[model samples]
Target: MEHFSQTLARAAERKGGEQNLFNLVSAPLPEQQLLAQTDDRCLAIMTKVVFQSGFSWRVIEQKWQGFEDAFWQFDPHKLVLLDDSHIERLMNDTRIVRNGQKIKTVPLNAQFVLDTANDHGSFARFIAQWPVDDITGLWLHLKQHGARLGGNSASFVLRRMGKDTFVLSRDVTAHLIAQGVIDKPVTSKTALKQVQHAFNTWQQQVALPMTQLSQIIGLSVGSNERQV
Candidate 1:
C-alpha cells in the first residue's frame, strides 16, 4: 500500500498548497461543543438528512422552516408523541415533503433520540463520545437504532453535525479499492473492518483526523467524478 503521506502530498498539490488544502477541511467540533448540542437540533438534522436522501436538497432547504414549525422544532418529546393522525395530516401538509415512509421516520427517529438521551444523559453526549476510529460501527449503530437512518443517511448526519468522521464518498471508495481495503460496497462486517483498518493505518502514518484523511484520499484520486 502507498504511504498516506504520498496521497496527502498529491492532494495538497491539487488543492494549490498545503495551507489551502487545510483551509478546505473543517475541524471536528470540540467535545464540549458537541455535547452542548440540543437534542432538538440533532433530531432536526437527522430528519433533514433522512428527507434529503433521494430528493432535491434545495426543496428541503426551502421548506425547512415549515418543517421546524410543523414538528415543533423537532423536539423529541413532542415528535415522539405524534399520533397516526399527525402522520396523516402531514401527508397532506404543503409545507414539507409528503413521502409517507419518510414522514413516518420522524416519530421513530425521535424515539431514537429520546432513547439515546435516556441511556447517555443526552444524545449529544453519546455522539460526542463515539470513537472516530470505528466510524463504520457508528454508522451501523445509527442504522440499527434510528429509523430510516441507514447507509449514506447516517453518514451524512454525522458529517453535517461536524463529528470527527469520514464518509466513503466515491473517490474515497475508489482509493480504498485501489489499496485493497475494500473491493465492493462496504456492506458486510468484513468489508467495513477492512476499511476501518485502512483508515487506522493511515491515521497512524499521518497523525491527522479521519475526516481530513478521508478528504485527502478523495482529493488524491482527483475530483469531478460523482460520489458513489
Candidate 2:
C-alpha cells in the first residue's frame, strides 16, 4: 500500500539472503514500469492493459511482444490504421490471449487515445485525472458493443497506466500485508488510495524512463514521432 513497500525499496531494506518475493516478481517483468515512462508510451501501455486487467500478467507479458509487433509498436499512427481483419486475425493468434472482444477495441482505443492526446495535450495528461464516470461510459459502451472485460479493475488499470500510483502486482500486495498496511494479505481500498496518492506525488516530482527486457520487443516501436 505504502510507496515504501515497492519491491526495489523493500529489497534495499530487507536484511536477508533470500530475495523478497515481490522483488523477484518485479525485477523481471517491467510492463508497469513502461507505463510510467514518457507520455507517449505511458498511454500505449494503458491501451494494452485496458484488455490485460482480468488475465494473468504473465500472459500479458508474454503476448506483449506480439501486441507490440501487431500494433505497430503501439504507435498511434499504425494502431489507428488497423482494420477489422487484423483484429480477427489476432483472435486466432495463439501467441496471445485470443479474447476476440478485447482485441477488437485495440483500434478503437487507438482512435480514442489520439483523440484524447490531441484534446488534452497528451493521453498521459488526460488519464492522470482518473475520470471514473467517463470510464463507466466507456465500459457500458464496450460491453454493449461486445468487449469482454471492461470493468472497474480494467478502468483502474487505465488510470494507473498514466502514473505509478498503485502496485497492482500480487507480490506488492502481499508485501503491503507483511508491512502492516493490512491485517491480512490484501490490497484494501484505503491502502490503495494512500499509495496512489503518494505515487501521484512522486510521479510529479520526477521523470523516470523504464528500461526493461527489450530482448523480445520494445515499446520503442514505430517511427511516428514518439514523445518517449
> Which candidate comes out best when scored by lDDT?
1
- Residue 98's lDDT within candidate 2 is 82
> Which run of 10 residues does model 1 get worst, by summed lDDT?
219-228
Clashing pairs in 2: none
**Model 2 misplaced stretches (Cα beyond 4 Å):** 1-40, 128-228
Error of 1 at 155 (Å): 1.4
Per-residue alpha-carbon lDDT of model 2 for 1-228, expressed as tens digits?
A: 334224334333342322432222222223445334444475356555665666787778877777676666777667777778888777788766788766666666666667767777765555544433233343343344323334344434443453322323444444435545555532344554543443343334332211111100121122212221
TM-score of 1: 0.95
The Cα error of candidate 2 at residue 97, in Å, is: 1.9
Number of colliding residue pairs in each model: 0, 0
Give the per-residue lDDT of model 1 (tens digit) for 1-228.
799999988887777888878887776787788889989999999999999998999999999999998889998998998899999999999999999999999999999999999999999899988888888899999999999888778888998787888898888988988888878777798898888899999999999988889987887785533322
